[model samples]
Target: MADVACEISARGFLNSLLREWTGWSLAPAAEAEMEAGPGDGRLRIPLPSRGSVVEIAVVHRSSVGLHVFRLPFREHRAGAPARIMAFAEFAAAVAHEPAIVGPEAARAAPAFLGRVFQSLSAIEDALARAPAPGLGLHADPSFQEAERALRFGHAVHPTPRSRDGFTPEDARTFAPEYGRGFPLRWWSAAPDAIVQGTSRAETAADLSAGLAAEDPALDRRIPAAAEGRVLLPMHPWQAARLTLDPAVDALFRSSQLIDHGSGGSPWFATTSLRSLYAPHARVMLKHSLSLRLTNSLRLIKPVECARGLAVDALLQGSVGAAIAARWPRFHILGEPGYLALRGADGAVLPQTIVALRDNPFRGSGQRPAAVLAALCEIDPDGRGSALADTILRIAEREGGGAQGAETVALRWFGSFLDLVVGPLLGMQCAFGLLFGAHQQNLVLGLDDGWPAEAFFRDCQGTGFVREFLPVLAEAAPGLDLGSGHRFTAAEAARIMAYYLIVNSVFAVIGAIAIAGLAREAVLIRQLRRFVEALAGTDLPDKTCLRLLLDAPTLGSKGNFMICFRNINENTDVTDPLAHYAGLPNPLAVAPAEVRP
Candidate 1:
């Protein structure tokens, strides 16, 4: 029981007083220090700010957004006192949102607060039931059961999405669901037998080892590798929707073996690709960010999302090329999502792959500086020009110049974001930022005692807009381009922060963390350089303030990139195209290979 500290706004002060009429301790302590949790956790107030103060002035001069009060454990115990502090915060939050909680009714505050307490208790109790330390981040119930089946000799295979195929009686015998699922953990030997609970329908016949042997019912033996390597055949259903670029596909199919992991969203498996070049193997798979569930079922907008993703993937490829090209001496591998040396069977050799994770802000500890430097030295002219020209031509065929909706131009901007800003940012920030730019999306490829390379994926997380339709139409005839809308100063800043600063910076931090160094120094150094660079360049006022002030300090190494939200509409603000000024136009289109 930590000491409880609480704070409420002036508007909620009266509500608390009314509730405390029956007597409640609003303030527990006078003041307390705040402490940050271990590694990227929250920094919260350690003790109560005021003694039984329901409403008090916040230290706004020092804090931003919301005020935090530390709960003092010395005074507040688990029984009634802890409940009091928790309820106070909940009541204040509920009162503030009249639309959700409803207006102040005649009900007493304590009664209302008690209901919230009960709900919290229920949630906490439910959380205790979870198998892992954190909910939703670990294996699911199905995964657990599958592991059990494998441990016993039985194999489990999944049923296709069909109800009619299953007889009601048969379904009852196997829990109504059957299938080969991703193996979170592999089993070496099968137990003697599997015992079923009384509630489960009895399968009188003893379960045998070959149960998964293509039985008309269930098959649990999935496509696995021989000799610690498994070749997970990308289900034909999944391959049907992937980006069909020859280069992208070549890299994708080259994985020697794939093993399924826990399934929830964007189901994934581990790859032995890295094992070809490096000591430890790594996993490679397409990220499933857009795929989610809702109450309503409808046709997914695949073409629209895929187009954006394809463009993003290409841009990411371009960024990788720029880095590799700039520093030939460094071991730079350029694949779609990443590059690794694989054996003839498409299995990555462990020695060829780096076993390090990517972290951009490792304080004074340095990463493979060559990669970062190479990214910065990218021939912005050569690759950037070719991409711009290629996209315009694609837009033309897609009806670019025709005045209508801004679809063509928006799509082009999506590609542009992938190619141009993505590459440029990869240098100053590190290549991994192109991924989700969030901690979870990043992985470190360690080599020797250092981080060797940074990899990024999840295309949707990257941001770009289609404001350049008019510009493209003016340059290329017979193209459908939209009359773009100019964003206000504030709106532009917000978009940049959301897409580039906040989202992208976090990815770099994840990469930097794996370098095994204190992030503070790295973040400060990067921040200093980023701020200094942006200060000279013309940028929105608000964006500048956030980089200098609002950015979280945990692993933020200065802000390095500014996403062009209003690419065409606001192009004149800071011209990415201007970088090509006076340079020989190397992007002149050659005969492009057209697929039938």
Candidate 2:
């Protein structure tokens, strides 16, 4: 089962890679060969520049246009051996292409392969364990179940599960998919050495006490000798690595920083592995780690931490109230505060930083909110998606059979648009606020297998138009809307289109189609109707909607190219919008039906 899951993920990676890199064209001759062949057939991708053609056996073709290919054969030369290797091997072999290889691929390949292995192991573990019953659709599903449900990571990313620094043991112990929890390592920072953002709590100690209130064991662990110091919690792995830092070492030697080792009740890892969740608590902790996951190192930069606090403050003010009035179901999981230790040179320590995130699912009365990514995940058994099964069950309850399923799917899609897309556009047009509403960053509140509410999280990717600075300033006085968080109107529009439209909305539509619940074209037409209605309104900035309707191509982040170039997603670039490549606009291709 794990092998099957890994292979499916590999095919997805290849499909995304081919789409992004190399102008791979279908050979006329290869099409003829496929037609002539019996049963399943092979397709060839002609790489003219490389003077090689790659052949793949078609396993399954998804309705959404994602091809699942197996038994890939790379023909380097006419007489050379047609090597049949695993997907990771094939990726490494192909990385030799100047167009595909990033400066860091050579350094990143080993780590990428290691992660693939870890992903397979994790998948095997999941399959061995008994499946959680009923798609976890109770009034409240276990947080750990939702977190672990994401066996496979980003479908489009070449190395979705790759973590550079972790061993197999570490992967099992730390990865969210493994469902293991461990105590956080504790440190003591002198009062003067603590750098923190303003929150309901006045000091780092105050925040620590608030966190400890959730678990009495945590409070008991605080030593009397640490009375004058701020309690600092760190990921155990991060703590072990910090010894190599000269500045941190010097601070430890000077008594400004004291290592208190691991203590406190275990905090479970969330889908975003660095973020930990205490189910009983009202807050989630986003901690900084040095390990590389997917495109970037999982460390929280000082600027990002500050931006989170600023965004949280902005959302709590008049701007937030205006948005809430417009769409009450659209919730932003605010990152209210953060704490970090400063070095002797006054530099903020990235590894020691922790951001406080709101926990919306604290009580039993709250509707079950599951990560959207988890819903889209392919079950290890390969029977169907959790989302598809849930939709089918709902359809059965409503009536029965395929027609009923289609009705439920269409209705669910419409509600998703109302709860998620409507608020996203409202925020952009009304407040000039752009949310990074990618699948992993969104949690959908589910009631009877339908999307009831949409919750957006992770403020690091959130942005605002520079034109709205005055409005934001008035709403949240003294808040620093950093230049990095500010975007031009055009930039904001493009980003909203990519994150909210291309990644989030289109992704959900595609997932629905791929699950065989409904047609992609129908869902897309529904989306078109929704956007058209919004465009007709007197909203200020409907550029995202207008662009989606009018643009020949839409901007999509080039994860393959970004990874190849070793682009640090955390680093501030002069042109942040340049990371995208043009993807054919689905809305433009499939026009909405003209109304009478």
Candidate 3:
């Protein structure tokens, strides 16, 4: 158990280090100074401040430059023969001095390490439990299992499972990995106190009532509340935290906000911890969690909430209908409405806000849709990834072996591009809208283990270009599509490329390589061929395509740097494209010929 814990911690630390190294463009000249003998993965890094060199053995090296190293140096201070420490310890030993490393990083190191350790502990706890049966996607899989199957939250993120505000008990109950379901804490809000962002329904009360109708128990609970008041559901954690706010407290005291407490059909926490899946209800509820998860607090900001409705309204128009007609397989899980409590001063209670999301996997035609992140996730039990497992099955049916696996991999990758990448590009080029098509936000529908359809979620991270504002306004008037989230052509191109190409497509290829199903080089060639063919089309925005084909480096989000700087991701920057650093563009490199 201790060894497993240590291993987990080391992996987290190495991921952090890799992000810092690559994202910050750290001097590789220093790394080149060390020499590794033939078949030797050992390297000695000089620690000038410590006046010593730390010897490390390479455990694993990712194609994206994430290298996990096991420290094998003796502890001189402790007088131990040999000691093993994670990257955090090694970073402290070499770069703790304020002069050596920046003051911000020096201060943030302890907090970052603490989160990494917490994440490691959580992952260890998750892995200790018996591996869930068959990738949680059998002939007919439960939605909860598909959600829980994403044991590790983020692929490239350093502390993907870290929940700073959560206690051990809270994690056991609310974390997706535990597969625990609990009733949401309910609140009865006066009609005057309720704020509706934008809804197809007549009023805010109607929206709340509509949501309640999904669950019979919840519906029953609503009428039992104070007369003329609407029932609003809240995450228990958020409900508890809201008590600290003076405005919310005032509302509670005035009886404007009646706490009905937790009672209703239980909702299971999805992979994105804040979103809850109500299996019986066939609706997903995204609540505002004040608790920090990954980069930011999982709260639905006012602008973001508005953006959801704006997106929904836009998608209901002629342009949206055209998109649907062109690419029927591509679906957007719309956030049709949002509800929140407003104080006497017209201030929104952020903690009380919740967005109503569409659940595509409720009934027939639901067809096993696996979150792309979950599909890429490596099973701790060495059973391989859901994606690899699915592909392997297909390969076995076609004729088993390395050659068969490669053939299946190629076919799957091609199909994945047509279903996912093609539609995403079309949306961006034609509509000037870009979906945040990262692995987590994308759900790929599988037809007998082959990619058939793609569904995208999360409106908050979606991007729109300024150049297309007039066109959008003409298409959908009266909608506040202008949330100041506009991006320039270059900015939109970079952001889209980073999310779709670097994060989604490249990450999947890396996963395939790690699974030993196919080489990354082959996958890269396949991606290039697909893009080159697309480039020949008469597309509106060739910026992304041109950049992908011509650019020497691609933008990559700096998660480690973001943590080190302690930036509030919500309001830190006006331009999100600035959050990324230049990374080597694999697509631009000389393409390998496809195997005949």
Best by TM-score: 3
Among the numbered candidates, top lDDT falls to 3
Q: Estimate each model's TM-score.
A: 0.34, 0.89, 0.90
Order of candidate numbers by lDDT, starting with the best: 3, 2, 1
- After superposition, the stretches of candidate 2 with alpha carbons farther than 4 Å from their true spots are 26-43, 47-51, 57-67, 70-85, 98-140, 201-204, 219-225, 363-366, 380-383, 572-574, 590-596
TM-score pick, better of 1 and 3: 3
* Tens-digit per-residue lDDT, 478-524, candidate 3: 77877637887788889999899888887678667767777777788
- What residue runs in model 1 are displaced by over 4 Å at the alpha carbon? 1-83, 87-300, 316-320, 323-436, 447-451, 465-493, 503-526, 534-596
Cα error of candidate 2 at position 294, Å = 1.0
For residues 1-596, what per-residue lDDT tens digits would candidate 1 score against the true structure? 11110211211122222211222223322332222111222212122222222322222210111112222212233242522344346344433333322343323333344333332332232223212111111211121121111110000001001122223332222211122223112111111111111101222111111112222322244412222332222322222333243432444464422333221212112111101111111222221211111110111222222323333333334543556685332222212222123344544322211111112322223332211111111011111111122223444555655331134333433332333233334332332222223322222232321233444433323332333333323343442222222343333334434334433342232222222222323333444444445445443233323433433321211110110011121123343222111111111111131111
Candidate 3's displacement at residue 209, Å, is 1.7
* Worst ten in a row by lDDT for model 3: 22-31
- Model 1 TM-score is 0.34
Ranking by TM-score: 3, 2, 1
Q: lDDT: which is higher, 1 or 2?
A: 2
Which stretches of candidate 3 lie above 4 Å from their native place?
Answer: 22-46, 53-62, 65-83, 86-88, 91-101, 129-133, 136-142, 202-204, 218-221, 363-366, 381-383, 592-596
